[model samples]
Target: MRIVVPAGGIGGARFLRGLKAALGIGADLTEDDPTITVIGNTGDDITLFGLRICPDLDTVMYTLGGGINESQGWGRAEESFAVKEELAAYGMQPTWFGLGDRDVATHIVRTQMMAAGYPLSAVTEALCDRWRPGVRLLPMTDDRVETHVVVADGDGGRRAIHFQEWWIRHRAALPALEIVSVGAEDAKPAPGVVEAIDEADLVLLPPSNPVVSIGSILGVPGVRAALERATVVGVSPIIGGAPVRGMADACLTAIGVETSAEAVAAHFGPDLLDGWLVDTADAGASVEGVTVRARPLYMSDPDATAAIARAALDLALELKGDRP
Candidate 1:
């Protein structure tokens, strides 16, 4: 089976891990194993200290490659912050975002590769050579697309800030007037992105932030159309009235969408999404023209996450069978 997943950061990475387990592949994938293509969100990409930081992509890579800090769901395990401390000691601005020494090496490599005229897609593939994440990870766009938040500037004015600064520095406390994809309008889908969606037997939208993560990928040209032609199912990030993790509630609110499983499904709509999975707590949730199934959505552990992934796979298979 060919599976394509459009994913974001921590939640998406962990869910992909479970999906691998559900498929009985894990890291022992062979030539005959099912192909999993992960279209990672790059909206969270930022350049810090002259290093290109692809947070979401690295999160997915590290988590799957067995080098992730499980407790924080990000960064490298056994990470040290000597570089960050040194930079802070120099009075560098925006010190709130932690930059680990081990993580910095990855950024340095990515920055150098990009500087040599390599596109982000190629750079990602090169990095994956080391991680061997057991999946083909592609960025949604090779162009420099970034997520920006519009917030009050405290002088009766408004200013746009990078999504990272807003999320990490302000902790998203400032209400977002608008969440903008800075370069999405002109950005083309990264190589193989459209192909992965169009040719896949199954496509999954993990329990990632719908607004800035999957939403950003959908913003890329031709992506939504490709999804419309496939059997696309999404696991709800919203469990009941709240987000499973992250500040997704804030993101949803910024877009004027209620943070509910049904609302998110409605937001994606039936034209793009064929199936939706909600937690048992969100049972009875319904979206017109979409198949909604209630399951345990909390990815509390590998076993639980695998079961949830299995439920999504089963739903997709059942829906696919009925397509004829």
Candidate 2:
């Protein structure tokens, strides 16, 4: 089946790995395998030290490419930070966001290619040639779109900061007064993004941050409309009234949505999502006009994660069958 997944960083990457396993694929993918296209969220893309860094894209690439650090769930495995130390010795600002030596090479390559006038979609394709992530990964938009969080300035004022800074530096400690997707108003969906969704037999939304990750992808001009016409199912990031990981409650609060499986399903609404999956802990959860089912959501291992992915795929297929 042709599947399209709109994903964020860690959670999305892990879910994608499980999806691959569920399809019975091994480490190396071959021709005649199922087609899965991943529309990676790029709203968290940032330029640091004159190099562009696409965190979500890299996480998905590294995770699926079998180069991910299992413990951290992000960054390259066996990675070192010699470059970061030298930069700090030179008194480079923003030491909080450290770039590992191995990871910096990717940013350098991407920066050089973009300087040579290649759009991010082309750059990502070239990078994937090496990782061979086994899926067609595309950025949500080639245009610069960033998620900025508005936070209290500590002086009784409010200020806007990049989402990464707010996430990494402040740890989402300060409440978010607002979350804005800067430049989304004019940004078009990246190449192949609309077609992937339009031509998909099923679309999956992994357990990613609803506000910044999936929300940012949908914020792109035509992505939501395309998804609305497809069979879409989402795994709830919220479990037992709290997020499975990350401070998604803070993000949900920023947008005035409750941190619950039912609420998130309701936020996406029946118009876009055909089915929703929540943890067995949240068994009785329900959403108006959307099919909700209970399942184990924690991706403890490859086997468990694959089961979750299989459940979502089955739900989408069932919903597709129910449609005219």
Candidate 3:
């Protein structure tokens, strides 16, 4: 089976790990695992200390690659802060975002690759060559596009802020009035992205933040249009009208979106999603053009995450007609 997943940072990476375990247990993927391709959101990427930092890309790389700090689900494990200290010693601006000494090596390599005439998509592939993440990880766009949050200033003035600062510095404490992908209007999907989607038997949406994670992926030209032709199923991150894991509420509030499973489904819309999985807590939530199944969406263990992933794949296979 060929599978394609559009994913975000931490949430998306974790779900993929579970999904891989589930696929491992099934007959479809054993000696020859299903060909899985991931189009990771790059909107949260930022340039820091003259080095390009792709948070979502690195999150997927470290997690799927096995170097992840399991507890944090993002950076490297057994990491140090020596470089962070040195940078801080120089009075660098906006030092709130933590960068580990070991993690800096990744940024260094990526920056080097980019400066040597490679797009982020190419740079990501080179990095993944080391991890052998078991799936083809591609950036949403080779072009530059950053997601910025429009927030209300203390003086009542509205201004756009970098996604990293909004997420790490203030921790999404302030209300975001709007969300924008800075260069999406003209951005094209990276090479091989369309082919992966076109040839996939099924497409999965990880339980990532909709506003920036999946939303940013969709912002790329032809991404949503490609999904319009593939089988798509999404696991709800919101268990009972709130994110089971993160501060998704802050993201939802940005565009006046609600915090319910129903709201999340609406955000993606029935036109794009063939099936939606929600927790048992959200049973009977009607989502148009999508089959709603209420089950446990939490990944308490590898077993639980695998089960949910299998359930989602089964649903996608059963509802292939939703494809255009």
Candidate 4:
């Protein structure tokens, strides 16, 4: 019962925790009986202070490894910010992003590995070696595919900023004119990404940021085509005209899609998505060629989130039956 998931940061990681719980896998499970393979979005990877900081991938790894900060939903638990504070004392630029001391160690290791001529996929695997996140996590691409947001400057000019700058610095307050994947046109899916999708019994799209998260992974060459041949089910990030978490509404609006479960499902479309799960509030929503199911999508706790994961898996199986 292999499952493939295209995921972003916090939301994706949390949903995966639930998925593991649903599969009766413990957080400390170190065995290779991984039924899940997570293809993490690397578009949010940024080079800061000469260290490569993969926010999305690290978030997933930490969360699944039981080292994630529970309240903030990112960064390391019991983290200290002495390094960031010292850098600020030195009057560094772009001090808006927070990097804790413990988290910086990860960036250091990743950067060192990358500097030694290791691709991000290999670096990620090496890092995961210590964390041993239950799932077989893979980066969406080994290439440098960054998500840049084109925003109007105060001087009435538009400039593209890294997704982190727009998301962390301005909190997506500036309206994004366009969300561009800087290298997606030439990026290839990571080594095992396509194979995971092709050999999966089911593929799940967690409720992450559609534009820069799951959307970025799909933008990688051969990913969407592979998905078209798999049984894929997506859990809606939007519920009742609002995002369940994060600023996904802004991302959707930038792409000219309405912030609704139905709109998002239609955006993914029947071509790649076989089934869609929306919150109970959106039970009336429907897409053209996708089977829709309604359930409580709020992942308030492990139990609640596991229930949602079960529902999504069940829906995917049901849809697979309808396919020829």
Taken over the whole model, the C-alpha lDDT of each candidate is 0.95, 0.95, 0.88, 0.94
Candidate 1 residue pairs in backbone clash? none
Candidate 2, 1-324: lDDT as tens digits? 899999999999999999999997665777878899999999999998898999999999999998899989999999999988988999997888858889999999999999999999999999999999999999999999999999999899999999999999989998999999999999999999999999999999999999999999999999999999999999999999999988899999999999999999999999999999999999999898899999999999989999999999999999999989
| Ranking 2 against 3 by TM-score, winner | 2
If candidate 1 were superposed on the true structure by all CA atoms, what would the RMSD be?
0.7
Q: Candidate 2, 57: how far from true, in Å? A: 0.2
lDDT of 4 at 146: 97
Model 3 error, position 15 (Å): 0.8
Q: After superposition, how far is residue 96 of candidate 1 from its true place, in Å?
A: 1.1
Model 3: residues >4 Å from true position, as ranges?
25-31, 321-324
All-Cα superposition RMSD per candidate = 0.7, 0.9, 2.1, 1.2
Please identify model 2 stretches exceeding 4 Å from their true place.
Answer: none
Clashes per model (N, Cα, C within 3 A): 0, 0, 0, 0
Candidate 4 whole-model C-alpha lDDT, 0 to 1: 0.94
Worst 10 residues of 4 by lDDT: 25-34
lDDT of 1 by residue, 75-103 (tens): 99999999999999999976988899999
